[model samples]
Target: MSTPTKVPLGSLPLPLSSHTLTKNLTPDRTAASPKAFRQVQHSQPSTQRRARLLSPETHFSYVAPNPLPFPFKIVPEEGEDVSPANQAELIERWLAAREALQEKDITERSNGLRLHFPAGREQPRELIGLSETGLRDCLPHLDVGDAFDLLGLPRLTKDPTNEEPQETENPARRELIDILSGYATLINVEEDVDKSWAPWSLRYSGHQFGTWAGQLGDGRAISILATPHPSNAELTYELQLKGAGRTPFSRGADGLAVVRSSIREFLCAEAMHALGIPTTRSLSLISLPELPVLRERIERACVLTRVAPSFIRIGSFESLNPPESMFFLGGGQQEKDLEALRILGKWVGRRVLKLEGIKWREEGQAGDAWGRQLVLESARRNAKMVAGWQAYGFMHGVINTDNVSIMGLTIDYGPYAFMDVFNPYHICNHSDGEGRYSYQAQPSVVMYALRSLLTSLSPLIGAENALGNKAVSPGWAKDMSDEQFAEWRKQGNDLVLAELEDTFQDTCAEEYRRLMHKRLGLRRIDLDDESKLIRPLTSLLAEHRLDFHSTFRRLAYFKPSLVDSPASTGNLESSKADFDAFVESLMALTPEPQMVDTFKAKIDWKKWLEKYSERIESEKGLWDADEDVDLQRERAMRDANPRFVLRQWVLEEVIKKVEQDTKSGRRVLGKVLQMACSPFEPWGAEDNLSPTDILDDEVLEERRYCGIGEQQMLGFQCSCSS
Candidate 1:
């Protein structure tokens, strides 16, 4: 196929200002002649000498390839006038427009780099028949390579700028939006894409597993690809490539992601997002037929286009060489760092906590009390994030500095699992043999990561006063330092650490209480006075070995309200009620609660009821009746009280499906993906309350085998079954 020629529609109507080209591009070495270079450079009228230096050669050029590979069709909505011809024309026009921009020679003078989007050798699979909105969502697949390109650099061609038009209605805007939206929908991705892109990323380095690595960047991911939302143009969905290729920070390793790992990542990302956890969404999962990666064994390679509010991690800033110099004393670079920090802090405050700008201000504070507010907000979000993880029984397995998000969203699903059994010390990843990231240790792991981040931010904020301006403020005495900032950070860290310990203690106490209540046939104790509940519960558990889940679920039914309520129990004495009804219902003997024996259990029922009533009365006295209690706080406490865990049964169901597929040569991978995608929901229709309907021991054992050796077992099964 012939390369499409650029067709210039018209020049930009506005007069080009010298300020437009603030960053100078490097000269092209392959310029046909110096005169040609001068002609291109001098094309724009440059009133300022600095602007004259920023010739077209300094600008980066990127173009979409013609004759896309994917088969797609456009389906316009009702009353929409987007005909097939118009759709084709729109695509053609887009291709032509992009080509024109790419052909323009751009240079980066400081780096001596002529930025050019050299067309990829292979054409991407073009998806058609999508509406403009659909196309916007699907752009991730169309431009997978561009996602990888943005990984290494601090800024992309389309950097977030204050002067840029917040909204646009042109064909370019429509096309881009449609493409991105389509990408998101096609890949079943769902995360708030509006707050996804960042111009100048926060740069930092990290100590990976204790080794201080300097200048580590996006090794195999990029974020240049973004399409603004069609309806709200200010919102954009970013397309970041994972395992697309290598960057300056590849660290000698091939930046290729294997298909198995890619599948796991893609599914988990979407799953986490669906479960209402803040996380990066997977827009597209593309298998690279041409690339076979060797990791443990040779496997087919794939690239996942992941969309996130921003890819800025604590490690990003830590990896930079001379991080303190870059922020405090550096030239123009410090401004970028400061801006990034502020943006990150604001995002944590607003997006995570739902806090408004006005709430950040303090009564006595002046000049951006937002920083202090930000620290508290970050702490709250981090605590809640831990709680969410606990509720789902999710073990991140590797809560490294690089893996944690400033937004407190869980990203990078490597070696992650939903816990099967409630073993706090259970480590999912065999590689983490040291229990660095065990189920119970995640809170501590997260705290450590946050401390490292705060440590990195200390210099910028002034280590002494917990205020960032002290180091840079001229009014401060030369002798005065950020010593208070250091102390404040230590205090903040201590508070967070203490909170984590408290949370873990509560978790343990709650679990132990439930266990006791079940085995000893004791009524569930109110945790208002944890010491009272904990002492009795611990004693009961020590006295008798009992299953945790069974015990609590049984006791939950033994409520006095059921037997003593006037409406239901008025004629109980005349009806000759027996305790069998209570026992059978309490034991979950019948699927339907009404079918159980009608007898009310009388063994110490009055005593237990009195204790429960007394606890309630005591709580009311302890807490002022007039005082408004935060219902959300109470709900959070209730949620934290270990209930049903989705991971326990979903894993079993997934493993069973995998086993069946392996044995029967049937493709049940979709079901597995579905299970992972909605980790919180039960599988199948019959067992909506249960994780999975399958309960046979033999089947479970087979499924367990399938899960452990999924890749090999599936291949073998496919071969034999076929």
Candidate 2:
């Protein structure tokens, strides 16, 4: 197909500025450029940037990739069109676009780094996607030869020009991968970033397995300060230093992470984000050679940079001196703790949620009007986030209050898994002994967590300052009896939980139904359609022990149409023969034949297929009525259900390869990363998008082994030892 020609809008050549990973593409060498290099000395993170939010002036700060890969580059002249119409283009076109440059046209210069915070103030730098910077070279795949040591990790060793670190902070070596993997050796934590910028610890309270665990805070995770993103200057990220050091919140163990756990998080974080799931983005992952920690065995230390708008959780509100305890006990201290909590709540709401009118100037009930609205917004985002999790087979092993993001992104990725099998009750996290955070229980757990948040915010909702004043002769007023108090109590109950529960239930159901509709390729969602189609498929999948993703892909090949039922035939033997033949025909459309057949052998596929056929027939006229309907239906279904999910077996094999040969391992991982990251690319030349079709035979053979020694990964035990 010929690519569509795009009309140019401006004559001003668009400059491609980036601190990219270098790749020696010449004869003897090949390299991948990291990020854009920032020359000039250290600058304060003050709001002293030259550009502001949504401004037309494209500054040096907005140079990094936001929705796309950071390490990629763009040049002047013929800019690439990334519209849906050009989705079928080769991946190499993107790789070669940057180097397709003009010598004189490209003016190489650095716009001395800009800061977001005020000058000369110690601020906390919470680690984020370790924006690619300072790396003179990029990492080679497993093809680099047998090299499995800390030395092979990607880092910024020096400036390419060997320019003295005059403008940029002394061009120091930055082993981003190892640093992010929780290795403390790569970065110099002792170096003072700024007079005002200093690392700080976060503290909050949360429930673990339905039990409230008090004073759980950032043990190893410390926030340095919010820095301007490579893409957006107005949007700042907290550069959290996870496993950097010990804080008061460091419960009882040393603040460090293991390589095994670090790599898993690094891969899963990007994988989730690529799949369009709201999650904390990972910038870099690094491993330390000699730094070993005791878990189940001697595992090397690793660090990961998990980037987010903010790391605040639902527990952040609960930690406030809440009025719930006082309301229940009656008569309490008139402390201003709840007032502070409300202030922070407003900041989070305005900064992140972009909701207006949160200023707490109003007195009494008016001062806390945003409280109920806050709960509703939080509920809506969490509902959608969890729904994404459910659709993609993500099992967040630990769903504690602290683990739940106020921003509604997946946080604290410990023992989480993109499940291999289609068991609704499957517990991916081994630490979740009671299965409270299992695949099926995610929605309920989130709802329950929200309810707790409401309980913590009750004080700000017109509950009067009860310090020492009250209608008291014996704690009761003679003018107003218990009747007046009872009325007040009832009104308070109405303000907190009543409307909020309705909002939570409605939003969750709506989001979930939206996802289900997509997965089933159904245009409309109703009780009839759900009962007749979606729900039945879910039940049948669980009963058959099928893989969720593969089974859905298999269903994409068949379009629904009303057909003669075998039972309609008068001859019983003939009917049986018809049923068998029907099943065989339907099975022919199946993807991943051997795996599907293993599950099909035990199930009543004939009956299930009949029900599904009836469903498609119900919507025969709604959509897919044309002769090309087969193409349209398949496109819709494939769009809704991704053929690739980061299954445990696949990830485990990749991990093992990395451990054996980082060179070859990196190459295979790069291929896997492409598929795992973007699941919605247009159909390739082969008319098949499955990675199993494209990967090397060795890798494909290993991917097929779902069993871990003896038992399958469904029973695999993973813990939060890191």
Candidate 3:
């Protein structure tokens, strides 16, 4: 309940020159911010920025030769009558092809997971039917920021672009809503004029736990449109309708997403984006009251349209080179599969990674050397991404290789949670019985994924050696004996893995240190800072079961200048009292109120404050000489420590309230989204967006749903059944 006021000290010891601090913060004045510290700006909503309106009649132009450049199966022609009987016939033929490829000897099956080869790499076909016609009546909840900035649509209520009659008026707005609702389609012709774009799902495989989970792909997700970035010409946006319908990779279960999970995915993606974490963006949430999807219970179905650079993942590569245990289902299509891997790798390198010319192919480097660069770049990006997750106390419950994005953006929001209490070993997914993807294990798990990616890329890496410099040849394996080919693959993977592992570890550790430094209001971090300050802070919070976000936020109020003042200055006792107040503030948000005094007595505040104060004093010169140093440091720390996170408890309340009353719940969702979009600012602080809603008093007020939950709700976990 108490807040610490700033205390001033004339000078501090070991202060570096202002020049030195300037260099440290901005080493190259002309260059951009370090990639490790970069934050996404599109997540924020601004009235001044406007984009072109998206409509069903508008052609979704794709920068790629083909929006989806993979082999696919043929289905009922657009005009053909796909009656139940005719559909059954089509399915039978598809099954026969699958049986021929699978050879019928492989009996191993769970969730009907099996390899599905396309009839041929020819015409693109519609994989599945859309949701029932009843969905057209529902309206979608669109993120104003995403609509305005990404899709070039005006906000219905509060955007300046509302003055534009066409954007604000009926048919255009209705058309946008229909496309998002999955009732209407966008025109497909783009740069690849000859290619017919259709709704398609990707096929891939990955490790579920630690073992290989064969043939896991997009079950409920369907890619429908690919459009150029509204602002950036070089960038292309691929929008996918998650929970759209079924595809070949749906396996046995019905491909549907429940309302609870869809809401979570929609909110968290924007929330993470607001937090400056690299992640996919949500365009809209279309609720289907007419259709109920059975998960653990019968819940209303919802379709979430998510936007990303590309949905390719580490598993995309792995799917091509399945384990030999798959009975070599790609046996007949081995060369074709290899070619697919090569093409996929090159596309990622050129488009996603943006490597090119000398950067893409160094002089005399193997033609496929970009493969290794792709792996390292992916490692670097992921290392920074996971480090951001760790610093913010986020645990992505299901980090299967399939969920790991090649672009290092956070994908698949299933069973994910932000830390309530600072428990290092907290498992957010109840289904994760082994705690394999726990908060503490995330970095190591990422390393596992990178290695899996490297293994998948081994054939491409070994192409030159296996083909005797004819790297473009797909049947490189045919030239060598099976043993020789295996040896070459192993050697290449080992070499690449050795280098990749080092890059990942070193990058992750460095990025983690940088983020931790920013979070703690420190401009400089020594080698011992982790042991003395960072790890100790973690231990102290876990020991007290203290709230993670609030603890760091409260520390911003503690004045480093006043800590350990000299007796001669007559401020020593007050300084010690001030530091005690800061410690009490940490216990202020603790769920175990009765244990607060006990925690205070147990923690070595004297020792911890000494180290923290000293570290702060060392970096004192980092502030501008003319500015107030404490205020500068406090602002930096507050920016790094968001006042609000899309906590699991908050999400639960929002979901419940929405089910109770649709209109009011929609308002609540928008209010929370506004809060999430500008997390660093307090709930009522202006960010040039929407005004504060009265619902904040009922929803975010203390003890209503504000602080971390108590009891079982604390560190809440969920089943992946959603």
Candidate 4:
């Protein structure tokens, strides 16, 4: 091992404002929070012998880059001048240049062991296997600096506006690419050259619609290592490869992901993170020109490495409670699996979630109190997550128990959608014919997954162990007397089933209402207005099938600046007149030229406006005498609405534009990431893109360049291929 070196824990040389650089250094800290980034609730525990970000460097290994699979190098008719170039020769030269890099990260191409699940602990072997080989010519599409902020590393000094990477202007940007692309590029961080970390795979099981499918784990993803978050030593984050290669869990499929799916996840993950939703953050996207994968047709494969505090999932625990088909793993030997489940429960609930002492459990006969707490907290967060989805009109097509993250972030974004016309019944995934995971049914699906998880914990907690309406294994308390087993089940049911039911329902209701209030620009008030204001407005929109996103975006621009401010606080007449003009403008608003089925003359637009305006007027009575109710309402709306969303058509346009031209595609993807990453960048007290559909407006003219809104993407179809 190289002699241990002491790097300052307090600070490092980073190309970021002190405010942005150390924003996350302090554990559970809200110091200098960036407006663009949300303060993630989960953080590493401070393991500070001192404050230093250590790099766990491994030995250098070189393998020739793979050539792009044949069909992707689309050729013109025979004798055409166009010919595919050699990828291997180019990759060799690239590797030669980066050979000097010997940083601990070994060139951040994401090779890390999971947070070291103890050996002999019986982790699902299928989930922890060798990473598929043949990592070839990595073409960097985009790297997000905000994601690196979690590490508190030297930032790339991000500017979403630039469609092209300005690697020349900022050396840190180049450094970020090097580290994330698995090149030996070190900016200003500490390293450990002696110790090399191994990669880990995880196993999980999920219900297709409500039935358990056994041994479904991280089929194509492998976690190489987990270390303390750079800024906050308290929390640890695992960087893992998605679409990297195959694992033992690959079943019959090739463990690969195409560039299109990779880009979707890359942008959407960042978009969700920026929107303040708890999600796994993406670091970098690398595409291999020649790798091929079968989707609807042949496509090039790519890899995306994402960061998360912990990748533990409901399925992680559920796998220990395997499906009936795999009952041999548990069956009469169930206690062994139970013990393993408890160990994992404690690790995730205590080490990761920090739920300890009484917060984790009650003093009783329970063997794993953390199991119950994990389920409860998962339910609470998932409840809010669903609420966020509904408020933002996001339809998560698949909420399979396996896809449902224990961390409560949206995982596995296959065939998801953002509803345009407020159809609570909309199904985003074309494969989900029964609407089992539709917009309105998300809560039930989320609840079903939680219940499955809760039931899986029965073995750990000594309760009735039944899932999928059929027992996966024999009951955990089978040895107990009938009375004891019955009592244990009753108490456990009341604690988990009854208690979680109430909490989930109550929390989801209040939180959904809270989100809707913000979307509609309503000021704080104790009065329940589901029937009064919200429902009526929703009814109006639904009746006419008005565009959900555009309607809300336009609502944000409706506030007359002069009248809503504190200056006009007591002047009721002037406020009313200005508000009337705003209402009139909204009533006379025109739909985008492409709207064949949107809000129309048939709906009582003026009547709905009169009701909405009167409701705003009613808020005056609730505010303190000096408070500007209208202004508060507008501010809330501004924060809630986003001008740009990752509409399906937009993504398709990006794929088409970039495939024909890499340089041009990279530029377009950069612009898309910028808008998706900074959804709030366009609107303010200054430029107003409202009074018309943002698609037709010039607020961010480039957003219109994608040619998406000209074709409504509300019901665009995406299948399970992703």
Candidate 5:
């Protein structure tokens, strides 16, 4: 057992500016008063418009150092040239590196846990040059707000020419845009610049669809830069390029992405952030017309610049112990593998989770305690994240262990969709034929991924058992007898698993309840309302195939006064007619609604509406005393239920326009992005004149972006290949 290092307790201070912090960390989000709700409703959009300018001295200078800022080594020495000298030797080294990584010492090349190398065997530099497209300028305003402000990056004017003519006239914005868009390198010696940023690919393995898929690493993704956060030096933000080129891990397929998937990922990342969900933000999306890629067909290639605190995944920890399947290709040294696991877990504890002030004991109990807490933290974050996804009707479509971010940020966007219809059992990814990652199953699957993460960290977490005693050799799982180790492992695993499940369930339930109640305009949780109103509401929506987003927003317009008056038969009849009219507005009618559909839907909907209205009337006083509670509730509902979501059909339209005509597509993309950034805001005359199909006609503008698509497009699904 290795001795634990005792470090003093420390705290990560919040950013000086509140706008720089994530939505979760902001204290104002928890305020329950109507005044606070109004403040929050306006604060987010205002924050999106504001930018914190960077000082000129540090703005353009590269902040990242040579070999990257992370605490790891890509090569044995600082300037070792491991690159093969000849084409024949390149293949030999590639084959040998794979074999060595699996069977021999995995960290022989790099001292750290991660096996870092270039993008491909022949392509020494992992940073691929990308061509600038019309969409380059459009990304600076993709609703990310001031996220990139702290990176010492330029804050582009809303309109380069109209808003800030000098910004467009100057060359600084253009030069920086080229860097982020991948048209230039980070450290340009030609210009005498020396930021020393190096790009590298990482190696990790995972369990794919419940089966151990050995050595599934970053095949198409490359980490281009990692720099200390301007607000807190302790934190670092990594910039990664998706679809840069093939890495050694690209098994047998071309490592490229088409504009179809790139645009979806690019828009979805920013949209998710705007919705106040924790996600990896997109900095830029650049199209390479000369770089055509083959998917279902040959499509123009593109690269998406992704930003996040950490890119570590559940598969990262799982890769520590090579599975039996790897033996077929080669084998792994168990001792070295376990050592790498310990190193990686410790690094994550201190760096990623930011655990500080732990009293390290000689027996290594501190590592166990930290590891256990890491699992709990991950569980809580994921629970809340999945809850947000459920509240917004989002389906990740791909929830493989490899895709699960350890920090719980929504990463690896692929074939993801926000449901048009409210169906609990909706499956957004057609490739998921078994429905393993269905909307209803997302919470459980996230739990499954967490369990996999826990299993990988069990050896470190099991150093000390629940009884606070060293049950086996502190950091080694195989030191004791097979029977004894199994017993010890079972006891430790059970203890941690129990705590994780409690955290996951409690956090998920609380967050989901809070979000749902807010969207429904309730002041607080009410079991009666849940059973009689909320539960029935879902059943009715699903029965009618009603659009999830529009239903919640339209329900805000329901006038409780119409049905809250005295229960006279004559009055009830007149109120019932008005109620029926309101109910018709909520229905997702396309082409022409069937009389039978409306008649049958109204029966269940009216029953639900009566219960809902009664609950709302009862809660009026609880909502607000100083203001009009009805108006307050309506405002709160509108704030919670966005008027726009980056739906699949909308993404298809945007992508098509960009592919057909880049010049006109820029305007369409920019307008849609603006709407995504301020989703709760109503479409107005300002938006009615945009040169896009979405705003071609003022009368149909809201329907184009806010309304549900045709019945056939309601439950649209896509394959994982997308």
Candidate 6:
């Protein structure tokens, strides 16, 4: 292991002398009560401590030759212009908000932790925490200072927090959207900008499998900013900076994410979101040009600001264990745990699962009927989430407890991939050499993670009530208690049944077998009749190892009569005409002559064609004409089976672009920010299909290779590398 660097917590560089601090302003002396005065006195020391911490030299190194760029700019909030008057008012409001939050003790915590508000400043810059090596490494290729020049944004010197600030006709509300839309880049300044701002975060820890992994806080990331949805203001989005520097929980490692990994995360999040999978959103990717750090061979690093409804991870809860445990804010020990779980569960159930009116109550408590409902809803939502992943052929390489979200949103994108080919088992992570996270193993892994999370809530579930903690025990009606237990059992059973159903549905079965035979130019087997379907399918499965997708598509188009009939001399001329036409068309694409011969040996082509025609005529309804039946066949032929996949390869290509730019020291700031702000719309450029569009044979070949690998591989690493 490499030696870790010493990272310092910085101070805020606000112009306090020139401006009165809003948070510390004295209220009207006569209006203040005695109790209020006492409270102020009690909190005075901490405020002084914060002020001391905010002083520049104590927190930062003034490296002048590499002076930081001014991070904030004035951009349009809407299409409306930003006038001087409006700007002044906006700044005042922002200042007041910041002060209010601070007065309520919402500022940065101890150590290097800080909050960052992208829209709070005039020109929003990426928050550079003490452990921000990732941004520093990518600064060479990225012009952090001039990132907004092409997007029609201008530099502004006036303070955004001024009480009576200038306003513009069109002022940008936040830089996150522009950066994501390929419009701006976030720069970092060491001397100026408030270092007092701490990212919004929750403390948590968890059990890794059955073993306790204590106090696993956010070792690298922080939620620094938020943006409310324009139309529905009630829904707010949290913008978190990953690898933005160190925090109290840094664990002696650089708090930065490598470019290679950052790109993977950015692309994967976007891909999953597009595929309709629940996942965290990537808002902006910023590269630090100056700070260099070594990771897997000194590669450049980058910071990705991600957006999500909540940043609550399983790890967050886990961190608040015995040592960090505190009061439940209003009540008893178990009460706190129960409340936390209930709140988190309800949010997950409603937002991620689209389930409304989910309720919860503490175990052994009177109102636990609601709690039971929350659990069931969570299970159903999780079941659907797993099914969606399977449908898209995606494999989440890592299934760590900490990585699993209560909301079922995929997070911490690492070695992951969509199956290139049809394989029952495929693994994506090379590190997971044990195949713990395989393509076929995801469902089980997810279940295991869920089970572990539930176990964490055991304390709240009153597991120790049998031992008699009078304060925690509810000596209520047995009927109510039994009902809660029964509900859990029912939900558990339903979850199992759902998983089984998904597995059964995903198996291609008869359709898959038929397609394989068709692709290999084998005799077409009739599936309409059970006997006919069984015999030929078995024979083909035994004879050749055919791929599921290719086989299914071919069977969808196969003309069975072409292989089951042969020519007789009595009608050789007409039979020969039809046979020649079929052979010519078939041979045009068939690579091996033996394949055609093999097909021919299995059936009499001419005879079968005659029989097929006769059967079609006989099957026609007594009053209906045979022409109608013929028309149906024609229509089926015209509607070709979909031979192409739109999800996997396309996503891979997009991920590749994101990865390349990140590696080359060009920030994906615009790409990610746009995605975070408007997840449904395409970001940047008119042509939105660059990743999916095929430019040449090589591109097709690459996709073919990826598809095939996906099918045959097992385990996270194996699948992802392939």
User: Candidate 6 vs. truth: CA RMSD?
Assistant: 16.7
Query: Mind sharing the TM-score for model 6?
Result: 0.50
Q: Give each model's whole-structure lDDT.
A: 0.40, 0.51, 0.60, 0.53, 0.59, 0.40
lDDT of 2 at 381: 86
Q: Residue 535 in model 6: shift from native, Å?
A: 17
Off by over 4 Å in 2: 1-195, 228-234, 322-336, 357-368, 463-493, 561-603, 618-627, 680-711
Error of 5 at 495 (Å): 1.6
Taking every candidate in turn, the Cα RMSD to the unseen true structure, in Å, is 16.5, 17.1, 16.3, 13.8, 14.4, 16.7
How much is the lDDT of residue 192 in candidate 4? 28
Best by TM-score: 3
TM-score of each: 0.51, 0.65, 0.74, 0.67, 0.73, 0.50
Summarize candidate 4's per-residue lDDT along 212-269 as a digit string, tens digits. 5655666666554344533445555556667654444555556667777877777787
Residue-by-residue lDDT tens digits, candidate 6, 177-285: 3332211322222232232222222335554433455444454565543333333444545556676544333434555565556656665675566545677776445
Q: Extract clashing residue pairs from model 5.
A: 8-357, 9-357, 103-331
Tens-digit lDDT track for model 1 on 482-550? 565346446544544454445544554454455333232333355554455434433332223222233
lDDT of 4 at 14: 21
Q: Which portions of model 6 show Cα errors greater than 4 Å?
A: 1-198, 317-368, 459-722
Task: For model 1, give the 10-residue run with minimal summed lDDT.
Answer: 713-722
Each prediction's total of clashing residue pairs, residues at least 3 apart in sequence or on different chains, is 74, 69, 2, 24, 3, 97
Pairs in steric clash, model 3? 51-152, 52-152
Which digits, one per residue and each the tens of the lDDT, describe model 5 over residues 1-722? 33322211011122222112111111112222223422322233121111121121110111111111111112333444555554333333333332211212132211112212222222211112121221122122122222222122111112333332112222334333333434343321111112112244454667666666666566567665554443345655666777755544455545566678877887787778777777887766666666657678778767777777778788777766443333322122222255456555555666677665554334544322577777888898899899899888889988988888888889899979997767899999988889889999999999999988887777556655543642223345435465654564566577699899999999998898888899999886876666777778888777776778878888888777666555643587787678768877666432335523777887787777777878787786686589887788888988898888888788888788778865445455656766676788865432344546453343355446665665667678987877
